[model samples]
Target chain A: MKELIVLSGKGGTGKTTIVAALAALMPDKVMADCDVDAADLHLVLNPQIRESHRFLSGIKAKVDEDACNSCGKCLKACHFKAIRIKRTARIDELACEGCGVCIHICPTKAISAKENDCGAWHISDTSYGRIVHAQLDIGEENSGKLVSLVKMQVRKQAEAQKARYILIDGPPGIGCPVIASLSGTTLALMVTEPTMSGLHDLKRIAGLTAHFKIPFCVCINKYDLNPEISGQIETWCREQHANLLGKIPFDPLVVESLVAGKSISEYDSPASDAISAIWQKLQLAFKE
Target chain B: MQIAIASGKGGTGKTTVAISLALVADKPVRLMDCDVEEPNCHLFLRPDHMESQTMYVTVPEIDLAKCDFCGKCRDICAFKAISVFGKNIMTFPELCHSCMGCFLVCPNEAIKEGKREIGVISQGSINEIETLSGTLRVGEAMSPPLIKKLRDMTSDAMLTIIDAPPGTSCPVIAATKGADFTILVTESTPFGLNDLKLAAKLMEKLGQKFGIVINKAGIGDGSVEKWCAETGYPLLLSIPFDRKLAEAYSNGIPIIKAAPELIPAFKRLLEEVTQ
Candidate 1:
């Protein structure tokens, strides 16, 4: 089985639009939304969840007020500055990684580690195929862990169902969650724009994919927005021997489809001819 | 006052606002571009001289000669960057966040610290604006560590502007974490509003007072203003969709410097944010 990940160095590059179109093209392929932080692939696929599971990425430290001696040892020991010495010591939930350093250092045994539910993942059935995705609660860290779990569940479902391919819509930027989305993928498809910053971030994310030794391809969305930059990107890809999969023209139908909560392929099949070309190139890249 | 300009979504004109605001700082301003992965504020500011410093993290290194493949380091690693099973231990350095949990918990004390250069921080002065930027090594996995380095280079000033990286992830949080106020630069589009909400959530979660600067303020809809009004958040400044400003940005020119008239608006923005 093969896995392909669609990612962008930055958001608002029409990544999900391409992913949804690819999913529509490959209706038999399993899909997973690894961009747990701001997942929108479900809006297109319209998955009906079959099973959901709580995802515990780490522990949350809770202070026991009754056992508090106000020693301030934990506050001093925490490198993250997660522990604050107020009237009583308080732990900032956002800052705490649940490293247990506070609990271990607390002389009064006032801190204890509790399981933290960072997010939830679901195995769902969509019009295209089986879908695996996660919903991360606002301000909850560990989207990376949840992304990993979602991919794992997708792989399991794909294997059980004997699917030949798994498609993942990844998060933006070169961060932990993006790294997690790249795991166990046969190829990466970077969807980028024609702006200067877009090309710059593409190079960064491309370097990351190369560092991971993942064979990747690029598709320039809105290639006509700045044809000069798009041309430069093509030449650079040629020099690097990296695949420039295809070019997606600036299409307003994309926004129309998105506003209607439908994939371009479903909304206007004729309007997505450029994206269709990208999908074909992707399929060819994998076969090669 | 140190102010951070952040947008959860990319291409939301964060660098534009940062450079423009820095250009109008009545005092000697320092600009820290914490978006190391895609540092574009420098493109606008155009620093004359740059001094670079490498940022390193300490990762666990087990002395194999000590004859201890006891797997203690592997077990203690929360990142699962290391793993030892049946006499073979594997290390994935890209996955390591360098929390030092493994080296601290090793029973045989066989683990030693090994340095991994994550990225580089560059310091320089652009025109009158003192600039510091952190650029993560292309393949390096971690970014907050590098952002932390850039933040440490800031001086106590009347106004210090930070151009934070896009997204509400670790890097953005690291950049805007301790700022006195945060200004979220966004557009009037739906995508812009969608991400602005996420960035607003981050500021609210951190208990930081913040306002919005709507770039291309009349492009698509009034969604940003609607959301801001519903949430009772102030709309600090609005930069209209000016083709001349966009053209200047494309040419690597600071908008405020190119068009001096905008300086008054930026000055007003600074005052609004500080007050």
Candidate 2:
């Protein structure tokens, strides 16, 4: 089985839109949204969740007030400033880094460490295939770990269901979650725009894919917004020896399709034709 | 006052709104770009770099002499940055969260705190605004530390506008935390509204007094407006989706520069934020 990840370093650049469109084209693939922090593919795919699992990672320290021995050792030991010397020692839940330093050094053993429920992962069936997606609780840390969990589920679903391809919608920015989404992926399909920010973001993420030694192919979304930058991107793609997939022009119908809860390919517009062509090119590139 | 510009979705014009706000401000402002993974505010501001410094985060180093194969450090670490292979132990510094749990929990006192270079923070200034941005090393796993370091460099200015990273996660928290107020930027689309709710939820959790700036207005439906009306969340500013604005943004020009009429709107945005 092969995994294809759709990544756009800058958000709002049509990564999920492309992923949704591709899911419509390739009905035999398992879909996974690794952008756990701000997952949106499920909104488009309308998956019926078969299973939901709580992602427990990172430990938050809890202090017991009833122990009644406020020696203030935990306050001094905490470097995160999570423990404050109020009327009594209190732990700031937001400030806590989930480090158990205070738990270890507490003279009264008043502090205890507990695993935090960071987020939830879901196994769902969509029109495309078995899908895995996740939602990280607001303000939760360690989304990379949660992303890894979602991918693990996707792999399991693909193996069990015998799906040939795993199309993953990755998160924005070249950070931990993006790395987790890209690791061991068969191909990196990077979607970018025609703006200078788009080019800059593309290069930044391309640098990351290069570091991982993952071969990548670039696609320009809203290529008509600025053809000059689109040309520059093509030149950059050629200079880097990366594959340049076809570009999709800007169209309001694409947004309309998303608002209507349908993929671009399902909606009749110029973009749908462009997307169909993109899929053909993508498939052709994958063969090599 | 510190005003952080944040978005749950990327490319929702967080930097554009931030730059426009700083551009139209009557007085000089400090704009700190806290999106270390992709700090593009400098492109619009064209700031002159004064100095740059490397940022570091703490990671634990194992000392084999005083160590036993008991796996205490590995068990205590929440990030799983350390692992034991029989008598030998390996440390993955990139996966480390710098929680100091391994060093503190080492019964053999075999672990020592070491620093790893994660990224660089730069200090610079445009005409009237000082710009500070952090750039995480391309392959670095952790960005909260670098974002924290960038935000730490904020001096006491009348108005310090922080361009926070996208998404409602640890990095966004690191960037938007401690700000006097946060301006959550979102476009008027399904994806935008979905992510806006998440960002707003984060601000509410952080106890941050925040308002929303509807960017790319008229590009999509009016569901965002209806939601804001229902929730009573203040809609501070709205930048219409204009071909000129989009083109100028693509060319790295501020909206206020591309169209001078937008200055008053941005000024009003500041008034509403500071009011």
Candidate 3:
């Protein structure tokens, strides 16, 4: 099968709205939400979780108080200053990366390594198909790892069901998590807005997808917000030889759908019709 | 004092609040745009650059001639950025977390360090406000390293404002980590409220004290204000929804310059923020 990832370099750019609509349109596809840091797909899809798995990024330094002497050597070894010399030298969970250096360098061997529960991944059953999603802890790191895990789960489920496609709702910006989402995807659908920063970020993300040699198509969300900037974006895309997928106009129904915890397809059929055209073009472009 | 204006959601006026606050501050200020991936603070601040530095990260380069592809180098990598099965050793530099495990574990000394340009660190003055900003190289994967570099360049002064990236991700954490105080700028919409809650959770977990500035306050009802009151987080200032200001911002002009009355509002904002 094929994998199609929907990403917008900037947040709140209707990336999830389009993903939701696409999911509804492509009923047989397995889905994954790779935006673990602030995952909100569950707000719309409301998948019934079937399985859950714990994710561990690294070894967190834990202070064994009984081992005695609080010499604070672990604090010195920690580059992040995660160790706090409190009453018994507590480890700040948010600051810890599970480096294990602090534990190794502790004079009294009081610091220990333990499996830190960074987040949880779920194999859920949605109306469209099976979904692999995750919820990261509020202050935890390792979203990149979690995204990878979610994708793996989706692939495993897809293989079991002989699914034809995998659609991913990706996070904004080209960071570690975004890189994880982009890797191994057959085609990337970059949803951009009609603004200067929107065009700028689309280029950044487009460059990233090209670096990986992943074929991509661009869809400008809110194309009517500024027809002038949208035209410029279309021109720039043409100059770069990138496919300019159909543009979706500025629609308030997208917001209404989000607030109602529903997909655009379910919330507004007219908006879904526009998204369907974009989806149809993507399907034809990536057809084997 | 270093003040980082951050919000978990984009287009919530983090950059606008930062630029406006810096503009109205009487004392000298330094504004650092830690949101390297999509930095728009310069669009409003109109920073005149005086220096620029290319930021680089060292990735491992395997020596083919030295040749023994022992799996030790790949085993220690927590990110799984490297893999060696038999004689085939493949390295994914983009996935590498730069832990130097591969270099230290290479018994044949086959691994060598190579520089990769990830982003650029730009230093300048925005209308006499000593500014240092980072612009991530297009297609670069990581952002925290560049953010750390920018933070390291901040001068110790009365007020050093950082325009943090949206979301409670690694880059946002890196930007607001050790700040004296954080100001979260957000709107009153449902999405804004949802993401602000995430930002609040991040600040609370980081143990950094912070207040909130409600932008486009009357667009929605007082839900944002009510949440702030319920959570005991201080509501510092409010900027009403004005089309003229949005137009000015979209055209790369400071709101205070476009509307002089905004200066007093921003001044009052800083006073409340510092208080």
Candidate with top DockQ is 2
Candidate 2 clashes: the total is: 0
TM-score (chain B) of candidate 3: 0.94
Better of 2 and 3 by lDDT: 2
- Chain A TM-score relative to the true structure, per candidate: 0.97, 0.96, 0.95
Candidate 1 error regions (>4 Å): A43-46, A266-271, B62-111, B242-263
In terms of lDDT, the poorest run of 10 residues in model 3 chain A is A96-105
**What order do candidates take by DockQ, descending?**
2, 3, 1
* Model 1 Cα lDDT, one tens digit per residue, B134-222: 88887676788788778877787446899998777667778998899999988776667777888888888888989999986666557
Give one digit per residue, the lDDT tens place, for model 2 in B148-207: 888777777568999999999989999999998999999888889999999999999999
Between candidates 1 and 2, name the one with more favorable DockQ: 2
Write down the C-alpha DockQ for each prediction.
Answer: 0.38, 0.74, 0.43
> Candidates ranked by lDDT, best first?
2, 3, 1
Residue-level lDDT tens digits of model 3 in A206-249: 88888889988999887876778889989999999888888897
Q: How do all models score by TM-score?
A: 0.90, 0.96, 0.89
Total backbone collisions for each predicted model: 1, 0, 2
Give the runs in model 2 whose Cα sits over 4 Å from its true position: B63-72, B84-87, B105-110
Interface RMSD for each candidate model?
Answer: 2.6, 1.3, 2.5
Docking class of 3: acceptable
Sorted by TM-score (best first), the order is 2, 1, 3
Least accurate stretch of 10 residues (summed lDDT) in model 1 chain B?
B243-252
